[model samples]
Target: MSSDTSKFGEYGGQYVPEALMPAIEELDDAYRRYVLENEDGFVDEFRERLRDFGGRPTPLQRADRLSERYDTDLFLKREDLLHGGAHKLNNALGQVLLAKYMGKERIVAETGAGQHGTATAMAAAHLDVPCEIYMGERDINRQRPNVFRMRLNGAAVNPVTTGRGTLKEAISETMRDWATTVETTHYVIGSVVGPHPFPTMVREFQSVISEEARRQFDDQVGGLPDSVVACAGGGSNTMGAFSRFVSDESVDLYAVEAGGSSLAVDEEEGVAPNSASLSTGTEGVLHGARTKLLQDRDGQIVESHSVSSGLDYAGVGPELAYLVDEGRVTPVTVDDDAALEGFHRLSQTEGIIPALETAHAVAWLEQATSEQLGDSVVVCVSGRGDKDLESVIEETASREIPNAPDMDVFSGGMR
Candidate 1:
């Protein structure tokens, strides 16, 4: 909410077609009116909805067993318990509220694992607005339960088959849809990506995570955690977790990425690496905002791979790109097998089934140490994994096969 900034230190800007400018302007104006200008209690109304309808003030719980195993103090910000089953609902509710203020009759959104799509659909249904969700055909199959949930919430799910048929393509398709229907439609971008106002807007909506966590951590732990961690795709969850802590230099921030198949690759055909974007990608634009993106030497975007459908993207949020350049956030990568192990570990040890996306943060513990992690660490368990049961079963079956590459990476976060 800094009046002095829109571009995140040269990482975020409006790099879209000229035709989209008016819609962006209108959106910015409406957001300022409804959210920033709050004499009418617009923000309080939103807070009421979040607490009573969407379930805010999600608990911060100590992970005694997991902490014992890791030999470090571990805490979980249980965003998994929120209604709609993920941190996606926070942004979805706020954006839908903005759409209502803008007099938009319909909502358009994109999803990778279907969590955001389902969350948006539920928000639209609650507010009695028509909703359309663009998701990849591949993601719909892997995340079928969420697809059904979206349908049940009265939202239309459009499958995008172009490109890698994942998050990036879904965003492309959503952008195309929003372009033509700008009059009646509002694009509820699910993550901290997209053009100027969006990356900042989503962060504000999701900032409730850190705002509540900071006080709760002080109350529970009697001090700030030494480190805060979350999985990063478009980086909403990570941004939320790190929002307040970023200014506290003594607290370390870690953003774990999806190391789909390999942590590093050089022109290997059919091999995709989703992690190492800020670490390896060049400055580029994707989904309207200029940031770090995986691309070839010719500047064409390359394919990104991930076992977790949610973290399967070729780019990250502009704010995260800024944080990377400033060295405020340490970027790390966790591969499929390691993340799967994290999923199992939490389920067995803590009785929590995390979404595959959140598992990537948990997977970082395999290679971590008490010295580096320090006495207290908080990891955002961003979502529950009920939607990923079938996928996890198949991944476990693949691991049972001898000579499977997964076994080697099981001990490490990288492929």
Candidate 2:
């Protein structure tokens, strides 16, 4: 992985224009220097802060009840236990610290689920730097809890209403903000997407999960698991878990995408629910990088829909798209019902309420059982359900077809 000139694979090369190349190159240089010269102490300090402040090394627990029910071995990499209640904080801390080291002030970021927004805000508060987060008006309405958390942490949240008022639009707003304030502001992208160093940089910070999970799983199971599973929105948690094990060909890496309604059918007119970037997306430029996006024949990006706010994007990270194309990663889709069912199952069975984003992985576990994955699968529980409670309750309560059969009637019968 290190031998490759690009970050993860060929998909992660710097793809910005000549004008931004210097800035990208400078960031790459700084990051490379920091990794080579300061990684040891930097990582130690970061880990200390994670434990004492950010709350990390979250447990890797056996989902015994779910495993028993599904007749498959299931373990959760409990990132939900991390401070700020998601895996976002891991990279946020790394980036914010890097900003401080570089003598930059005023952190800026964009968020969809608000996990990243809250994480960035928390990091800025800890480092005593002013922070601003751009969120979609739709997301601000949906993820109210996180918006409140951001304010409490002393960060300003700006709502963007252009376009469809979703993640893609918020990203555009953020980029515009970054272009205007590039000198003194560091734009902390939430996930392993975007252009150049962002995909590489975010992955490096989040790679800690794979590093720790490998050691923990090795100690507990005597070797690596048969497969590593994670929910991929912007592909951070999946990248976090897969980065360390990418060289281990024996371990299968599975990424679950949000199949909103019918996994077998597209929710969009003439596009299948599974037709999002991973499946139907074509190579194109979006969010400052050439990536696989679900676009029309005329190259207009099509709107994407998913019950989970985090996964409702029209494009995926370039690296992930390359991984999908190269067959290094297998992408699976789980419908909204399955995801909600998985969310309820985890909450009732293991007392672990997962974020709607993380629930995608849980839903995949249900399918994995029928395929007989044996007792060796680890799912990245990327975020907690605290941010998703109200929506989950509302979703689970609204019955689909009156008198419809309750698939999980035994799992406490809806929220």
lDDT of each: 0.87, 0.80
Q: Which residue pairs clash in candidate 1? A: none
TM per candidate comes to 0.94, 0.91
* Model 1 per-residue lDDT tens digits across residues 1-415: 4332669888888888787888988887777777878636779989999999988899999999989988888999999999999999999999998898788988999999999999999999999999999999888889999999999999999999997688888999999999999988999999999997898889989988988889999998787999998999889999999998889999999999988778665565633576557667789988889999888776777888888988888889999999999999998888788888888888878989999999999989876767758889999999999999889878877774232224354468765
lDDT of predicted model 1: 0.87
